[model samples]
Target: MDDQTLRRAVNATLMPGFQGPDLPAWLAAELAEGLGSVCLFSTNIVDGDQLRSLTDAIHATNPAALVATDEEGGDVTRLHHRAGSPYPSMAFLGHLDDEAVTEQVGWGIGNGLRAAGIDLNLAPVADVNSNPRNPVIGVRSFGADAGLVGRHVAAYTRGLQAAGAAACAKHFPGHGDTATDSHLALPTIGVDAATLAGRELAPFRAAVDAGTLAVMTSHILVPAIDPDLPATLSAPVLSLLRGQLGFAGAIVSDALDMAGASGGGRGIPEAAVMALAAGCDLLCIGTDNTAGQLAGIREHVLAAVRDGRLPEDRLLDAAARVGDLARAVAALPRNDRSPGSHVPDPRAESRPEGTPHLSPAGFWLGDPVHPLTAPVFLRLSSTANIAAGDTAWGVADHLAGELADRLPGSTCVDAADLTELAGVLDAAAGRPLVVQGRDLARVPFLVDATAMVLQRRPDALVVELGWPELPGAIGIATYGSGRGAATCLIRLLAEGSR
Candidate 1:
């Protein structure tokens, strides 16, 4: 009956890596005490062998530790931190437009991650890219078309689940159509009921129908549902995802470290308590911060229970949901549908009873197209031209540096002086042009320059790295114009061209 133990069981963490096969004693201690999950990020991952060792060590301590990663397999990835994601983003897949192919891509991503000791993939972004100015979720989304995105969501969910890693359909209710990044500031979406039912909620409905095991909440404000609170700390919005959408899966929160959920001026510990009270089963403590940050969260959540801010039964319900998810991901059988109905099967997860499968070294993506490799993901430079630019001259230079990280020895240019930029475009000639920066719709220079380049190469891949998207590019979005995004986009472009 101790909330102390219960609180420990509900937190999912991003831990720093250790020297070798063994993790730090502190992490081992956290795992032993029933930490619900271990999240993998770029910092925590080095390569396949080291990551497997890390996960294996954690599993030894906690059988159901739920090893997961943000391996969306495109711009936003953890596995391909050092190299790059060999697979396509949801935007790329959506362009491919074949449901079976989308499922195949999802399976490939899951298969690769599972091979590296991941049991859950926080991927296949279910949000629709309905807004060009959405800074956080442009290329991460499948597409602007709701029905099409819904199809991909179900397909990707089914594929990942089939590949033995549970799929987490994310930003529940939808993070689409927002201008602000929750990481920096809270965003508000003021769509009416009809718009939500038609656009925002469609993909989630498909995800639930596809039997997704988990749904992560957005930190944005949806005045239509809950005006006063951000969705992560909003009981009404979560209830909508539960009662209305019929999602029986575990509901997790976006990282509590984000400014949106940090209670404006409040500490993260208080935010964690509110999130749990709002029906989040798993509280994601971002790995960017240390485990020390979680100590206060654990203590405060327990205090919330003792002081009646959070009901004891609600905490139990959350813990139960987390346990259910852990069991489900580990592929153990549960007789009851309720949370915590399944007891810990030490042997069940000890050996990781995954369906006999290999991490697909090379796999087919859209259509009967080319097979993709795991590491040296891209190698295409027929014209020796991968031109890149930014709206501002300074960012253009910075963008060029990042592009080189992915595309070696490619030409880089800043868009200034239409005549000079046009001359540069002429120099690129038949090569693929890569543009990085804000949404294309808002920036007149980019719009004009992109139009000029399209006259030369109609299929140039325009990417917005961690910012708004450009609408009319061959590929609508890639999360950020970093190494991961560039690698994926270049690969996609190479395959499509061939």
Candidate 2:
């Protein structure tokens, strides 16, 4: 291949994220040179108008370039990262077992993305959360049951694509059963072949059958398939997706900067080559990518192709696949309107006049607890997972702000031990206590603290902002910490009092 052909092929497979809300000079030049895609992170976004302008600038530079973001609509939202998403999570939809509602949520998210000028959404986590302790995929997954996850994955894919934005079913071969976060380190899926086929592969198959335009690869090792390489760098795993699942769409690699892919002394550029050779059609270089890093990756890929380490044919195939997806996305109907302008108001559905509008964000565990009167919000905090980052979340703050007059005192504490729990409870000062937490079931200390609080103050209301598994607590599980869940929980509390 000549230098121009090689450069174009290399650029087509590279999807890098840049700093700031504006398109940088380097990135604009890259886009004009046939860079197939660019990923937008929270840093690149400010508001709908800013996002639209940025994406419009990208498209203006290269009309064929695809713009993508991780807008999974729940905890992993990009468009609404600052305030949290206004939509229910997959787990909430799965708990309701309503496919129509799930589709509507997908459509709403897609419309939001479409309005933002984004072409692709790397979302609809197809991983079945079989392991409750999964640090990365907890509430992101639909459910623990493979069938339920598959059903919702298909529904979400159909809805997202139907709304003019391409949906990419993610973390292929499943990242649900592992306890480790791939962002920090590599996790090995220890399940056998049959177990893998029965549990993990089901959702990917469903996604393919649903006409998903892209499938994102996970960075975990499946000893059942190949003991050495992670799925992002395993041809056998990619073949399994292509042959058995019959997925002809693009295979997107998780961020190469992740420790799971770049750890053990391998750099992002090398990982990009390995992922492409392993059958990934597009390589996500990582967030806040610099021009120097992009140049390094391009040089590494070109060298690999010239040295015959990565075949020219393989590079061409990957680039062609990316180009095809970009063309398909370009052909989708454009929604130039402002975000959420055309999407139906999910909360506007008919309800009895004067009754509280209970959105899908609220999932009642036990009976409705005693209503809030002079409530004191006590937050039991946990370490934020790397995937969710340090985004603003939780219902306590939102509720406190909304019901400031009713709230006497509100404090957030790490209730890691009995002493901390005692302090937290004491801070409530015998007022009607409302304990707020996220993924309480995953952390032993939070569970123990919550249980002790409930035992001491059985009248206390427990609100779980993450996946709800707090047994014996008469609480509301919002299934997410997004603004939607917070609003729903507040309405439920207000309604109960009335």
Best-fitting candidate, scored by lDDT? 2
- Model 1 Cα lDDT, one tens digit per residue, 1-498: 765566565554222223333466777887888777777666566667888988898899988788877877555666654444445557656765767666766766777777788887887788887887666676678889999999999988887877778999998889888888887788999999789889999999999999999998888999998889899999988998889898887887887777888847877888888988898888776655445765667778778888999888888788788788888887822212111112233322311222111111111222332322221211111110001111111123333443444345555565554687666666666555555444455556666766665676664544444334323453434434434344434445334424
Q: Where does candidate 1 clash, by residue pair?
A: 465-480, 465-481
- Taking all chains together, each candidate's TM-score versus the true structure is 0.74, 0.91
Off by over 4 Å in 2: 333-362, 399-424, 470-474
lDDT of 2 by residue, 344-388 (tens): 445445311111233643375566445566666666776667666
Model 2 vs. true fold: TM: 0.91
Model 2, global lDDT: 0.81
Q: After superposition, how far is residue 67 of candidate 1 from its true place, in Å?
A: 1.2
Q: What is the lDDT, from 0 to 100, of the residue 484 in candidate 2?
A: 63
